[model samples]
Target: MTLQTVILAAGMGSRLGRSLPKPLTELSDGRTIMRQQHDNIFAAFGDDAKITTVVGYRAETIVEAFPAADYVYNERYDQTNTSKSLLRALAATGKAGVLWMNGDVVFDPRILGRAIALIERDQSFVTVNTAKVSDEEVKYTVDAAGHIDELSKTVSNGIGEAVGINYVSARDKKAFMRQLARVGDQDYFERGLELAIREDGLRLAPMDISDLYAVEVDFAEDLERANLYV
Candidate 1:
């Protein structure tokens, strides 16, 4: 499979109150967060996997860190959210599908390998964590048939938290992008996925990743928790 990676790394980590861009922040293992994602995805899929990173805040710094990754700059990154960032990155991909992730996520390389294997089997899906969820986490619910019925942070009765790791297959790419482009800058990429599901019959079932560790770094506590996991 041609596993292309599109990583959204544009946001300034203002919530963390850090001067450095979030992706440039060093983790407990001494690898910068973006470097870790880049290294691990390549490790999981081999060097043949094309890596594309969408950058804005301190984009030069990220480019310096991983020159090998194809760069897509989100000029309106400050005003836009994941939906726009992802759309811009996807355009640069020129592929029918891609393995997408947030730049701040810290996880086991095997998770990437597992996600790819799952996509190879099913062709499309999103990673989910069924064991644990918090009010702050982006949650999702799968129907009795195991197709994702709803996905958003406001889903109070969710069955799992979305890990922000997804496989967009060639078959679903056009509809996915159409929904993504229909959204406003304030909306999340999840909104686009939801639109795709409702209007385009996109079925992004939940692939359990509860057996693996994956944490998105958004605050100091999250950073601490991620370090401990690593």
Candidate 2:
């Protein structure tokens, strides 16, 4: 099956203090964060990967940079959040399961290799870094069955940090889409996942990639750390 990959790039990223879309921010390796992501997808999936970017908050810039990519525009980008942007992409894509990531993350390419089996098995999952759990980042807790029970920035005593990369199996796509639609405008996509797990019994496994480098560039310091891995 051809892998469908989406990049959530609609956020204004005001915290990063960049005029350009956060995904377009340059890394030390000369590739923009999104560019690195694009390369990683292609490297891991080869020609079997289809890429679609959800663009807003300077959508033109991201579109112009990657003319080959498919795009879905988020008209209420400034007013909405990741849940809406991700909803738009999911609605626009085909029936295949999707692998998606936040636009600003710079991660080790090997992480994708690690996820291939899960994708092929049609397992829904979130990539996590068990080595660090920061308050500002999205955190997760597992249920008795070891499935993701809680997911959000405010999750206390979380086992790890969700690294902004995730996959939704085709089997769970419609259920997840419904949950996403029910979320509040400003709620992150994690809220939708939480609802899906609670209301629909969606089992989301947490894939630990703590041994690999994955940084969501939300600030100058984050960019510095991501650059170190680039």
| Number of clashing pairs per prediction, in order | 0, 0
How high is each candidate's TM-score?
0.96, 0.98
**In model 2, which residue pairs have backbone atoms overlapping below 3 Å?**
none
C-alpha local distance difference test of each model: 0.86, 0.95
Q: Estimate the TM-score for candidate 2.
A: 0.98
Give the alpha carbon lDDT tens digit for every residue of 1-230 in model 1. Answer: 55778999999989988888898878988988878888888788887888888999988988887887789999998999999999998887775678899988988788887776666764678889999888888898876677987888899788889998888888888898999999999888999898898899888878888998898999999899889976
Off by over 4 Å in 2: none
Report per-prediction Cα RMSD to one decimal. Answer: 1.2, 0.8
Give the Cα error of residue 207 in candidate 1, in Å. 1.1
**What's the residue-level lDDT of 1 in candidate 1?**
52
Provide the lDDT at 81 for model 2: 94
